[model samples]
Target: MRPFNFEKVNSGAEASAAKSQNKQFVAGGTNLVDLMKKNITQPDILIDITKALSNTIEHQNKGVTIGAMASNTKVATDKKILRDFPLLAKAILAGASPQIRNMASSAGNLLQRTRCPYFYDVTMPCNKRKPNSGCSAIEGENRMSAVAGYNNQCVAVHPSDFCVGLSA
Candidate 1:
């Protein structure tokens, strides 16, 4: 990962105001850090939003409000979440491992990138990795490729169990 400026904000508003081109908001750094290490994404600035966001799960009149910084483990084990959205809880528990789920933030999980092999390989031509480059997964191994909501430009599938559960 290349050297980047690090800024810590104390609120969501501050984090939003700090946004700029080639800047990434990092809470748990589960996805962003990995992408940085692989050179998939190189941001010139990293806005640490962990302290700037709420990590608690608040119950609301209709349902619940899950903080963006809330960890997967917190959401999966929260009594209200388990009672109101058991499927969501189960899905969160089913993802990654205990350690990863503990560190992966709710927003990070929701914003995860596709797990397509071609997208990870820099040498491979992937439209998702580099737009207009061509999608290698379209003609290559595509067992996990998208069956719906896919165009000719890309066929990659998001690998987030929590997202699938939320959709259902």
Candidate 2:
């Protein structure tokens, strides 16, 4: 991993102001850290927003408003979520292993990248990983590729158990 500057912001406005072309907001660091290690992303600055963002699960009149920084495990086990949205809880629990869910944030889970093998391989050409580099999964092994709603740019399927539940 390349050296980078890190800052912990205390508010959304601060985080937004700190944003730049070479900077990225990090919450749980689940996806961003992995991408950085893989060289798929190389931000010069990382603004830590885990504390800046809300982590509470709010009970609304019609539904629940889950904070972006709330961990997947927190959402899955929240009393209101389990009582009001049991399916969502079940879906999140079904998606990632217990350890991952405990570390992954709700917002981070929603923004996760594709799980395509080509995307993870820096040596392989992947349009999603590097635009216009060409999609390696097209002609290569594509069992996990999308059946529909795919273009030449990408064919990987979204792999988030929590996302699936939220969508439903």
Candidate 3:
């Protein structure tokens, strides 16, 4: 990964205030770190919001409120979620391995990058990774790519099964 300054913020407001063109808010670094290592993202400042964000799973009126920083494992194993949203819990468990679930955050999962191979390879051209760079996935192997909502610019599919479950 490129050399960058890390800042730990204690609140969303502070994170927002610190965010700028060269800064990014990071909760779980699972996805962001990978992208950075691949040179897909090079933020000058990384604002860590994990400590500042709530990790609680609150049961609201006929629904649940999962904190942005709550890990997938926490959400899957939470008594309230397991009891009230069994399918959701199952879906999350089915998505990633146990170790990843323990470190991956709910919000971070939703915002994770596409699983397109080209997107992660700095040597390959990808529109999503670099606008107007030309899409290499279009003519390459794309069995896992999207069939809908795809255009010339990008055909990458969202790589989160948790997101699919949440949407359902």
Candidate 4:
């Protein structure tokens, strides 16, 4: 793993300022840290957004305005979220394991990458992980690939059970 510089940001503006061509937004780092360790993601600087974003879950007239940094566990178990959106709660439960849910943020979960094998293998060519690279799985083993919403470029499925529940 590469030893990279870390910057503690206090606000979105600070985060934006700290960001660079080689910098990445480090929120939960549940996925980023692991990817970095694997050298799949090489960020020169990680702008920590955990402290910057408000983690409060507030009730609004329409619904609830969940903060960007609010953890999945909090969102899944929130009384208002569970009661008003049972499907969302169940979907969150069905998605990631308990430990991941505790640390992963709702915003991060919503921005998760596809669970495609090609995307995982650094050697294989994947368009989602690397834009314009021809998809190798277009004719390869694709029992898990998307069929309904797939395009000619990529057949990767957005793996988000909570997203599906939220949409429903």
Top candidate (TM-score) = 1
User: Residue 49 error for model 2, in Å?
Assistant: 0.2
lDDT of each: 0.87, 0.88, 0.86, 0.83
TM per candidate comes to 0.93, 0.92, 0.91, 0.90
Model 2 deviation from native, Cα RMSD in Å: 1.5
> Over all chains combined, what TM-score does candidate 3 have?
0.91
| Model 2 residue 131 CA deviation in Å | 1.7
The stretch of ten residues in a row with the least summed lDDT in candidate 2 is 143-152
Clashes of each: 0, 0, 0, 0
After superposition, the stretches of candidate 1 with alpha carbons farther than 4 Å from their true spots are: none
lDDT of 2 by residue, 1-168 (tens): 899999999999999899999999888887889899988899999999998889999997998888999999999999889998999999999888888888899999998887687888999988887789988888888844788678777788887777788888
Worst-scoring 10-residue span by lDDT in model 1: 143-152
Model 4 residue 65 CA deviation (Å) reads: 0.9
As for candidate 3, its clashing pairs are: none
* Tens digits of per-residue lDDT for model 3, 1-168: 789999998887888788899999888788898889977889999999998889998998799988999999999999988888888899999988898899899999998877577888788888888789988888998733888778777888898767876877
